[model samples]
Target: MKFGKIIAAGVLAASLAMPAASFAADKPVVGLVMKSLANEFFKNMLEGAKAHEAKRGDYKLKAVGMQSETDIETQINAVESFITEKVNAIVIAPADSRALVPPLKRAMEAGITVVNFDVALDEKAKKEAGVELAFVGPDNRAGAKMAGEALAKKLGEGGKVVIIEGNPGADNAAQRKLGFEDAIKDGKLKLLDSRTAHWETEEANSVFANMLTAHPDIQGVMAANDSMAVGVVKAIEAAGKTGKIEVIGFDNIPAVQPLLKEKKMLATVDQFGQQMAANAIDKALGVLAVGAPLKGWVKTDIKLVTSDDVK
Candidate 1:
């Protein structure tokens, strides 16, 4: 009887320790790739991802990004590194939507689950590449539509509004522009001109400066991102018409908050990038933990932030 008791205790101890070993071995690993670390929006996303990693003991995360938004090659290389490291999942805010497809497809084919956030993957390309990827991000078109509708409300129809866009290849930029177009189309807002600034503040400043010269009577400005929007405000100021025109921007970056608070800019769309990152991490981990299949798209919240929304 004593011998039987000893055997039972040994079996109980082995059973208890098995879970610890299993958990340690079974922890999911994810790689987070962003456009560029220089932008506050991407930095905020990284912070949210890291904070989530710290709180969740069941996963490990590593983050890497390009130094500039146009560095598609660097982004591709980063994905390759993650692939070599054999991470179970990859969550990326791609630098360029179409360019990242090949590398992302390679990862997916290598048995890694890939989740895209902040921008969308080209679905046609994904099909062509013969690999699948899951997407998580704000509805860029809807968010921009919100900003456009708010600007329309302020302008009250027939207001001449110009659009400054980001990199032409950026999926989010295109979607935001589409949203702006959709909103202004119904409102019959006169489009003075639209130009691409490649998500550069200086380029946007120069572009809007020229727009002001060509269309001095413009009543409003629509920007695909906050950086360009901030640049538009600078141009308006340079033209000595700062507070006269309604400027609406997307991505409620902190730098634009002052302009909003002072009522120089009408409103911005808060894409909630941090929340997007958190949700991406959660979904990526789910893929590795239980083979939870993330489907076509997982969109987060978006809000129209005005001067009143700032405080």
Candidate 2:
């Protein structure tokens, strides 16, 4: 009887231990690949994704973030690693639109559901790779245009302005640049020089300072993200242009709040970064369950924030 009891206890212990492993296996593993966690926007995204993983309790999430904003290699390696692990799904906010398509296509071919968010992959690249991943993010162009238009309105027609762009190859960067150009055209603003700071604040500061030096008559500045906007604002302060140059940016991160409130930054676009990854994860899981890929763009909310909104 004692021997029997020992066997039963051993079985119970094994069963208890097995449950965790079994449960984890049964749940879908959704791999999340995000851009630089160093940036406030991506940092918020990571936090929100963690909150979502805890709340959902249905799926296991493996998230990987880049070392820097321009780190496409990390993202590529991350996708390859996720593929080797054979995760059920991959929800990626790709660093480079074209470069990520190939690995993502391989993931799809391996029967993994892939959802692209934050930035849409290039159409030509997708077609070439035969990848039809759905983009689950905001209308970056429209959002950027809204911010640009606010700057345009503030500066009025014939306002000399320079653009401090994001990463060169990033899709969102390209779209935002185009949007800013659209606003410049519509607003009849003078285009001085548009250069990229690769989404770094310090770089933006340096670049804007140089541009300011080149074009001292610059009336307005449009930054692709709020981080860069903060940099531009500092450059303005250092150059003694503080209240003289009107600035606008994207991503309504907390750091930019004071800038907006103080009227240092004319406006910014809130694309709801915190919830973006979660929303994309939801779609990825839905695709996994339904066995149907998400089609086209799954547009999310984007709003323009000005001093009034902050106030």
Q: Judging by TM-score against the true structure, name the best candidate.
A: 2
lDDT of 1 by residue, 1-311 (tens): 11110000000001011123333587767788888777777787788778877876668888898787788888899899998997777778776878888888777667677777777877787688775555655688888898999999889879999999887887888998999999899788999899998877778999999998999899999989888888889988888897899999988888899999999899998866665566766655555545446555645567889999888
Worst 10 residues of 1 by lDDT: 4-13
Regions more than 4 Å wrong, model 1: 1-26
By lDDT, the best candidate is 2
Each model's total of backbone clashes = 0, 0
Q: CA RMSD for every model?
A: 10.4, 10.8
lDDT of 2 by residue, 224-311 (tens): 9998999999999999878999999998999999998998989998877787778777766665554555455545678889889985
Looking at candidate 2, the ten consecutive residues that score lowest on lDDT are 6-15
Q: List TM-scores for all candidates, in order.
A: 0.89, 0.90
